[model samples]
Target: MEKIRLRDIADALGLSVATVSNVLNGKDSKVSPATRIRVLEAVEGSGYLPERAEVLLGRNPSRMVGLVVNDHPEYSGHPLEDPYNARFISFLQRAAVRHGLELLVKTARTWEEAAQFASIWNMAG
Candidate 1:
């Protein structure tokens, strides 16, 4: 069996790669139901799996906020020892959910590692 790329499927369906990519990634905002179904069928037949991060990055922000909690021992102890931090984190999560936004949480052991991760994820605060 031969592997198929997204471009190949798009070409076969007489659609632009971006249009096909959007359909495969589940962006239904600008896509009609009929077109979405067709693209999905083509994708299934082609055995192509779109990259999730690429899809996510292309999506419009829906009140989504990424949170990075540096829980290093030097900063804060276990949740049992520092209940305030835990409570704050819980509150943020609840607030994000209430607003229909996803909260991405990341923990780092070292300050350097935290900085690097923050930079990579564009979560600098």
Candidate 2:
């Protein structure tokens, strides 16, 4: 099914696109309760993903930070078990959280594998 756009909902309800946007964005202080209810109903009926709504409005990338770590057969535990690696991971995690992003730690055997991780979500870090 095609992802529903705000324009479709607004047109169906005879409302301006901005009004529908405001209701979805929780900026509906000035919108009437009846209008809010109508817009919300349309949204639910459309199978719209709330996360995608922000992306459509702002064209934002997937807010993820990917950490590529090397995995060797001889390693006992996670590569992050090393003290230096652990500290670095902790710092990176803190930064990602501070910026409203998530840290995805993955072990890769080669550069090609690491590249796949980055491309999957448009990883920024």
Candidate 3:
């Protein structure tokens, strides 16, 4: 399949590419809420992937932090069930939101899986 670009999203939402770019770049103050919703919906629905270069350059609002926890053999239940894990995630989520970042929590039994997940998502620790 062809890669989805910002222009495609803009066309899908019937908005200018510049407007979509602004929204994705976190400069949406000039864009209307309705338009922003439409843009975001289109982006999500189309499974659009922004340019990695843009994300790395901090041009896009794709600042994401990955939280990896390893406690599989010792713990039987989900990681969220642990009080300490829950509290840590809560604090991390709050900090991420406050700084306009996205927090992705992933639990892996092995280092390989954790590394794979982080590599796939281009996540920063």
Instruction: Give each model a TM-score.
Output: 0.41, 0.47, 0.50
Deviating ranges (above 4 Å) for candidate 3: 1-61
For residues 1-125, write the lDDT of model 1, one tens digit per residue. 66577889989988889998776544657988888778877776665644543354454643556665667676565532457767887898898778776676667665544543443332213
Q: Which pairs clash inside model 3?
A: none
**TM value for model 2:** 0.47
Taking all chains together, the TM-score of candidate 1 against the true structure is 0.41
Report the number of the highest-TM-score candidate: 3
Model 1 off-target regions past 4 Å? 1-52, 74-81, 119-125
Record all residue pairs in model 1 with backbone atoms less than 3 Å apart, i.e. clashing. none
* Poorest 10 consecutive residues by lDDT, candidate 1: 116-125
Cα lDDT of model 3 by residue, 1-125, tens digit: 88788888888778899999887666889988999778867776786666664356454545789888886766785877788889989999999999888899888887656754565565545
> Predictions ranked by TM-score, top down?
3, 2, 1
